[model samples]
Target: MNKISRKGFLKIAAAAAMSGVTAGALAACNAASSSTAASSGAAGSYTPGTYTGTAEGISSTVKVTMTFSDSAVTDVVVDTSGETASYGAAAAEELKNQLLNAGSDEIDGVSGSTITSDAVKKAAKSCFAQAKGEATVTSVQLPTGDETDWLGEEPDIDEAAITETVDTDIVIVGAGNGGMFAAAYAAAKGLNFRVIEQNGNVQDTRHWVGAVDGFGAQEQGIKMDRAKLLSEVSRYASGKCDQRVVKTWINESAEMIEFVRSIMEDKYGVKMIYTYGDEAKWPAENAEHNTDYMYPEIEYTYDRSSGAARNELLLQYIQELGYDVDFKTSLAKLEKNSDGRITGIIAQSTEDDHFIRYNANKGVLLACGGFPGNPYMMEQLDPLGTSVTTACSYSPSDKGYGIRAAMWAGANLDKEAAPMLFDRGVVAPGVDGGYVDSDTAFGGKAFPGTIRQYNPGTQPFLKVNRNGERFANESSPYNDIVYAAAHQPGRVYAQICDANILEDAKRFHTIGCSAQTRNAGEAYVQGKMDEAIAAGALFKCDTLEELADKLGFTGEAKDTFLATVDRYNELYDKQNDEDFGKPAYRLSAIRTAPFYGCWLGASLLTTEQGIAINEKGQALDNDNKPMPGLYITGDMSGSFFANNYPCLMAGVAMGRTLTFAMKAVKQMAGLE
Candidate 1:
């Protein structure tokens, strides 16, 4: 048997064809063993020998050799034929320990390696069966439920089966910003709640690259005006959002921010700093024009602080509250009584494949984030968002599991919210990954390049199709860039920019710059240009025509491309853009002696569509009514933002939603 690495396992498993095994029957195997032991002399007394069994989802084949004498296990040896490296090796070591310790067939499960443990147990069971001269292994009966009824009969409402069970006063799905806050809020109210995270860790990817801006919290005595903050967000959201929701978000934003600040300072002993030079502020002129009649009629204020620190602090606060939080446990199904009232939930731990039925005695809050990880779901939800790669590092488990599980529970589905979109700056191949608002990558130093070169926040640089023809407005907002990228041919690109424009980005690292602008500017300074050139981020040339030729733009289109650059430079000189309404300062002439173009591609972080919930954060059915005993929050509940850009601060919405749900539950229970 050969050893396999963890990376090798993940890479191989991505293409490995898996056959379904009966999880329920296997669960029954545990129960049957316990029952048989009660009826017989001793449950531990079983023959030990080498077993041959096939279990699905194991990265590689495992050979287990065991020796037993006097009805007691003596020694166990485990050799892997092929498996992922670290995880498989860890599991193999754990299996040897368990087999040796049990002294019998009834071995307790190992943590963080539950699924593998089950596989090893099954193989051991096979060995025991063979030693007993059994021709066929007995099948165990598993607990069953109505999956069809849970998912309903409608195609629009996507549903999935509930796999595990947990018992808690409240169950919050998703361990991202919102879900964590929900747990924290519940703890503040003295409620028992459990956060079920599908990922192995909390705040997986959604908040991993986050910059906790837009919250009206005061740090170092610098308080953001809450009303002004609300007004700003409303302007950004384009007045299409629910006013009540927006108001609630604004009003609560400050409290959550302060809450995070307190936790970071007091508990974690981490001083939250206010660094103000990384972002490009909204021009005073544009701010004045867009400030009035903003959709939610609120102003926006942002805290240029570390999103990772904020998230980590908040998670620590939740842990301090004594709430039970489990990671790698996925919600499999929602259980209900005959009256269609949600009674409990079935969840399975990816670690062990063990199902836990969580009885939500109060209510269930679905805070699982959006579904950018699932490509098929993205294409189905927003046909225009298909071309983008999930540029940021996020949770692999955030594949719409909670959304699907909720929809299966007869929840209302919001098709329009299926594909959440976000704008990501192009990272040249040799450069590090795309720039994050916070400096989680790059040692906390802002990327070095001017915003003029890469204004992903505003509009993407001129994107040329395979034939080098420009499509869509190059100066539109990031969302528009995403929409156009999806519609563009071949879904590929080379974004052209010049050195002068890159030099102008150096000012972005100074104080009072927006985090987004700072991130863009720093990309060049952080050796993004050189890195990208080395990594294939840029196609370089001595002349504009040569650059164009390298990019595959030929003939009439090449001439047109040059003409477009000239016209754009003219607009820059004149201080206005007639084509895309871009502000003059953002425009630049592309006639630098040495021209460079970086290949840019579209990507996403979360799915946009999810179960429909009302403004009060109640999970609604297809008829637009609340699902009894169920509430949804976070990305799993739709109708928040049109695209993904921290529409609201993480944890704020979840905090409020769960608080309100807790009150509603109390009222429902006649406790208040």
Candidate 2:
């Protein structure tokens, strides 16, 4: 690429500005993008029924359903195919609201997200023709700048109101694993730092992380093979994880582990338990709450403790080290100096909504969770994955404020978003206290169910789609039913298990299958699953054919399902699965009188995909260069994993969060 002269650059920028392109991410937009802005027509000019239309989004086609009565837009719903949950989801609702408020489709799109907003408008226009009406369509104003706000517009902040400013060497946002580690290490390094968290207490947050991979476990009698670990990580990440970042994590994890071990075991007297095999794997901490799989090294937990204990202990030590920390302090936004360094951060106190400006002389480290709590973002980011906003595993602090703020400040994001979709949860209704019945669990445009619900029928069973055919391996290597089920037809599937399996799940606590909760996996089994049957969540039948009918399987699909089960049983008897190659010991035939079954919707743990960041934890710009003073860590730096988060290196993200934050601090403090 040739560099343009200053005059040429200014002319081109002027041209873009003249075209109504505001402060938004200006990228290679689809030339064919459309919008439905009407100039001279009234909104109440169409027929009064539901109509469907489609528009292309950045990643996929968006299906929009527009409803009109008396020619006024009454309702607008959307299925944004592959649009990001972080941006498009909110765009859908906001666009709908705009249409309703304006009583027409002529409204301008939201700032920072002109493209997605235009798509919504275009789809609304598609419905106009069906109602015997026409709309004056328009095109989106494509941005020319690399940086844009959430609405895809360039941001212009006014810093006239300083209010308050506290000078600090380091400003850390969110007391998550990354933020906590940054605080500890910065204190240890004698850097003037303060940690700010949106959540008040450690326990109130979603800190239930699992596993921390590293070596030097002689005392715990666990040996780690670094080479094999790296290979496994590469395989699990499917070659998407940056090799530089992976190498750094693998090389430094042992030291991080030693830090944790010294504080956890030797100093704090926290018990470190090491277990072998995948017999009972839930958290890497060996605290089996049912659902088990093979992660021999991962199931290392503190003595009868969990992720919360680990953080609380770290917090204790940080406080003991006399570090300044503030809970319930949210990272509102970042302000950059002319040198492109993050000079200050605007934070809002969650308790009373008081604002404070933290003037950082050195740097600002951002690791404030992901966009799970934002309902629209959960859908837009991982459309193939279900998102019951009520069920995301975090507190109310997971709105992606930090990530979006960084983007607004010129940080780049990974459009190839990879949410952490796992197969460990239950589907409940979106409404308050409304449990999503098993039958209608997977029928939504997005992934269903509350995330990380308590051991919702964890033991892996033979899973089949609505077509009653097997898709992926039921178990092994984290083949999450959440992602699979979301893509399945009707987004619904059944977990078929025999009465014996359900009974065993209840009677004994086994791998990934917990009957501890009274109505859990094994507890709900009976000759007839009356409650779930009434709730349309479960079905029971004496014969396989009858079970199929009760669940609406017919013809070829029914036959294929029966054959799949028969062949599965055959493989079970032979003690070998030649098809998907599921381990024989873990395989169980779906055979038993009066078969027991329940509908399954996958769970959203924590999304690992976030903004793109370089090895030094600096958030990258559109050119893939580090945005000085604007650094990202934890899930906020999303380029680490792609496609899926593998179980191979369980708890590695948590470790990376700490290690990476410390690394960024070191770089800023000139200690590296």
Best by TM-score: 2
| Per-residue lDDT of model 2, residues 1-672, tens digit only | 222111111111111112221111211111221233322235556556666655544444456666655445556666664665666656766777676676555778777666566656656655554444332212221122111222233223224323456888888887877877777788777889878776666523222233334443455566656666666666666777777777667666666666666777887887665444434333342233233333444434566444437767778888888875787665656888887878978765544444568988888888777765433355556655543222334443455667767877888778766666545444321122112322111111223343344343455567787777887666543436555555667555667767576544433334322323323334444422454456555666798888777766789988988888898789889977687765555578777877766655545556777778877778888888888777788877866877766643445667677668778888879886
lDDT tens digits, residue span 1-672, model 1: 122111111111111101111121111021111111111224345543333343322333345555443255455666544444555446677777776776444677556545455556655554444434341333321111112211212111012222434567777776676776666666666776788776556664222111223332232233445566555545544543445655554454445445544555555665544332212233333443242211221122223354444445557777676655787676666777898888867666566444567888877777766655433244456545554442543344455556666776788777554343444445443332222222111111122222223232333345555455566555433445555665555454557667554453333121121234445455534464565456544566888888877666678867877876777677768867677665454456677777777656544545645676665667788887878778766666665554444332323334433334333334334445
Which regions of candidate 2 deviate over 4 angstroms? 1-157, 203-216, 220-223, 276-299, 304-308, 350-354, 386-396, 425-451, 454-460, 480-487, 502-536, 539-563
Report lDDT (CA) for all predictions. 0.49, 0.58
lDDT, residue 436, candidate 1: 25
User: Clashes per prediction?
Assistant: 76, 41
Using Cα atoms with residue i matched to residue i, what is each candidate's TM-score against the true structure? 0.64, 0.66
Error of 1 at 364 (Å): 1.4
Question: Which candidate comes out best when scored by lDDT?
Answer: 2
